[model samples]
Target: MTDSKLKVALVGCGQIADAHLGEIRRILCARAVAVCDQYLDLAKQAAARFGVPGVFTDLGKMLAEVRPDVLHVATPPHTHRPLALQALAAGVHVYVEKPFTVDVTEAEDVLAAAVAAKRLVCVGHDQLYDPAWQECRDLYQRGELGEVVHVDAVLGYDLAGPYGRVTASDPDHWVHRLPGKFFHNTIAHALYKITDFLRDEEPRIFATWFGALPGTDCPTELRVFLQGADVTANLLSSSAIEPSQRVTRVYGTRRVVEVDLDGRLLRQARAPTLRGPLVKLELPWRQKREAARSLRRNLWHFLRSRLHYFTGMHRLFTEFYQAIRTHGEPPIPYAEIRRLMAMMDQIFRSCRANERLSALANEERRLNGQPVPISPLDPPLTTHHSPLTNP
Candidate 1:
């Protein structure tokens, strides 16, 4: 709460730390003052890359010496809780990366610590602040999208992608140790968007998971159905799908809004009023117009250098810093964060239940001298993996 630029420190100099550092530099009200990592060399490397003035190998040393106003916890999911609690206790605001904690219980603890310390905390649900999503939210708020009825959130993964390949090959990765396994690290991206639109306090969740990859226990595919008071939602995360997509489509009583997160595009589809041949002739024309509009908008953004892959992260950082300066509500509410974590807990619980049932069925089949189906929940299939940090 300084009138001058805020001093920022980052812990966990992992892959995601680079993004956080870069975005912090973009915020005029904040600057990266120091960085810390368990490994000294990694800390030095991040400081050198980001031009951060201070570097340390220990969290306590960095906190006491640099005394930053805000701390970014980009560490592994399992480490998030302890690291965040430590920062909050030191009177530092915190911005934790996605999947805030391994589960809801740890998340609650971190929030409680923030309250006790009279500090603010924010989670990295950056996609919700992306341009396309912002537009969708505006439309919904303005009654352009009408009454919300259902939502479909889909995230596609590539098994051979940079981070994916590392987790697939390294059996000892920290992500593998999370309670929800790999899904815990990535599902928050899809769930947060659903929770934004479906406001029911106690939503009912039904989840199914499968290991699409023959040799992996990672459960590469997940499907979840959620029922709110008046809105229903479906979430999907799949590695088998080609042309990897990140999209959320919200269906309302009057129209549908599709947010193409990867492409940074938003589209609206309204109920057709034209009849017979006119309806057929009009829809394609409308689609073509939307396509052309998207092209122009994207081209403009590209020329202006605004179409960045991390635009959402930039916006979230700016808003969080503003909240710190103004003592205003955070960009993403605490209640929403808690609700999303609870939803994730329910999803993973269902996955674990399915595993138990599958095991019992296989055991019964063995007693009957029949061939037992391979269980996707078998050992060595890998569990949790993080897109942010390995440490």
Candidate 2:
């Protein structure tokens, strides 16, 4: 544990902030010094629950009076850019939630602010910390999985009950009142994970398909064509399921791996050897169980699976601590996050236009004045094209 404790301010008191608070307690070098929210009562509640002494409804005032070392922007997506810019301008490290901003343009502005302030700016893409995903990525990098050929990821659930109502609420409601679109909130996590694993070559969308959600105007389906590793990645999400589930599959030349969202179990299948038509092997789970035993062990695994939940908060505090101590970039840098925002914009545009959108490649060509090269890992753009039908 670090000897110095970093003073942290949480800017939102929503449901996700509770998870952030938990992580803050876990990190011995951090303390929640202040809380801010549009709702004073909510802010007060968070402060009381977390043992924070300062509470305010205005972030500007909190920055002025408390001058927190780090500001955690846990507010809605639309407010992410402004709040993050404010924190960066104040010379405070910022940890903003996913979909960093509503649009790529706003994302660029956030990046510029971070560069100008010389302060670290990290976005919450916490799933990268999951042990299972980390293990899979490590193996892939070691050439154990061979060349990744395809990726199929699904992030969706049925929400026909109370959850459905929340998703279908008025546009003014915090849940539904996004400045840009809902895809950024829901699918960005999966996309980030996908891109992280396939970082060698960037994937461009060749096509998109969409569906309807009962209560909301959000697109329910996004089938994207990745034109790099001869692969296709399909991302499907909906607010219409009874219970939610997330699964990711990576198909490689030598083996196939599947990981559930919680990262509890990672199942893999390798190519057949000379023994017969097929030879299958599984990771050593029995040995894993023997290595550790206790409630804390299981709880830690559970925490690892939901690591993304606390990423923003953890990053916010960690960056602030690092900024004051070492003066370096945060865990998540701004350039990579800008790429994520741009990728999301392309995905949503493809979904809305009912066609494969080449926004990213087009932008690259416009900037560099060169024809985009084919991505070896992505499927051919012209082969699997399913365009979205605009409403």
Candidate 3:
């Protein structure tokens, strides 16, 4: 809450840090004054590359020296909690990366810290602010999509992508050690988009695993079915034949809106207005018109990307900084973060239980000298309508 420009410091100098720094630069009221990493060289490199004036190996020392108004925690999921708590305790606002913390309990702890410090905290559920995703939300809010009857968030990955291939080859990669493994690192991007529309508290989740490429370092494929009070959602993560994909679709009683995030496409499909046999004659033109309009909007966004690539992130940070300065609500509430972590905990537990059951069945087959077939395990949990809103 300073009248002058807010001084910001970033603690993690990873790949995502580049986006954070870029967005911070775009904020006229804030500047990234210092950068810190445990490895001094990494910090120095980031400082040099980004022209950050101050670099320090020790977080506490850096905090004492500059005392920036906000600290961005861009480290791995495992390090988020401790680092965030440290910043909160020092009376500094914090903007954390997603999956907020590794688990529900830890997320609650961070929330408690924010409460005690009387500061604001926000998570990096940046997809909710993405232009395409927000456009879909707007349609639903405007009642164009009607009540959300069902939601689908699909994430497609290439096991051979540069980062994916590196993680797959290195069993000791930090990603493999996460509680939910590959799913934890990627599933948040899927769940938050659907959760944005779901207001039900106590949602029931049943998950199934498909080891499409079994030899990968971690489970690279998963499907979770979630049922809420009145809305149902499916979260799918898989290493499919496609190179990559990130899409979220909302189905309503009136129309359906599908957003291809990676492709920057948003399309809506509805039943044709014409009736009788003549309906077929007019439907094709209407469909083509819809497709053409979507392409036009997506292409506009693509051209704008040349100026600012992380537009969603830039918007998120700008709103977050405004909250800190004016003492308003955070861009994303803590209660939402709590609910998200609870859902992740459920997914991890269910997936682990499924894995254990499969192992037992495989052992039984070996004991009987029978062949074990490659197939997905039967989902052990049931999905039911429970309007319990935990957040």
What is the lDDT ranking, best to worst? Answer: 1, 3, 2
Evaluated at residue 376, the lDDT of candidate 1 is: 57
What shift in Å separates residue 275 of candidate 3 from its native position after superposition?
Answer: 3.8
Candidate 3 to native Cα RMSD, angstroms? 3.6
By TM-score, the candidates rank as 1, 3, 2
Instruction: Answer with 1 or 2, whichever has the higher TM-score.
Output: 1
Clashing pairs in 1: 175-384, 175-385, 176-384, 181-383, 181-384, 182-383, 182-384, 217-381
- Give the TM-score comparing model 3 with the true structure, all chains together: 0.91
Candidate 3 backbone collisions, by pair: 201-388, 201-389, 201-390, 202-388, 202-389
True-structure RMSD, every candidate: 5.5, 8.8, 3.6
Off by over 4 Å in 2: 1-3, 158-164, 174-180, 200-202, 206-209, 229-232, 240-243, 272-324, 355-391
**Model 1: per-residue Cα lDDT over 197-303, one tens digit each:** 89987787767688733344667788888888899999999888998789999998878999998878778898788999899988888888877888898899999
Best-performing candidate as measured by lDDT: 1
Error of 2 at 207 (Å): 5.1
- Output the number of the TM-score-best candidate: 1
Give Cα-based local distance difference scores for all models: 0.86, 0.68, 0.83
Pick the winner on TM-score between candidates 2 and 3: 3
Weakest lDDT window of 10 consecutive positions for candidate 3: 380-389
> Whole-model lDDT for model 1 versus the true structure?
0.86
Considering lDDT, which of the candidate structures 1 and 2 is the better prediction for this target?
1
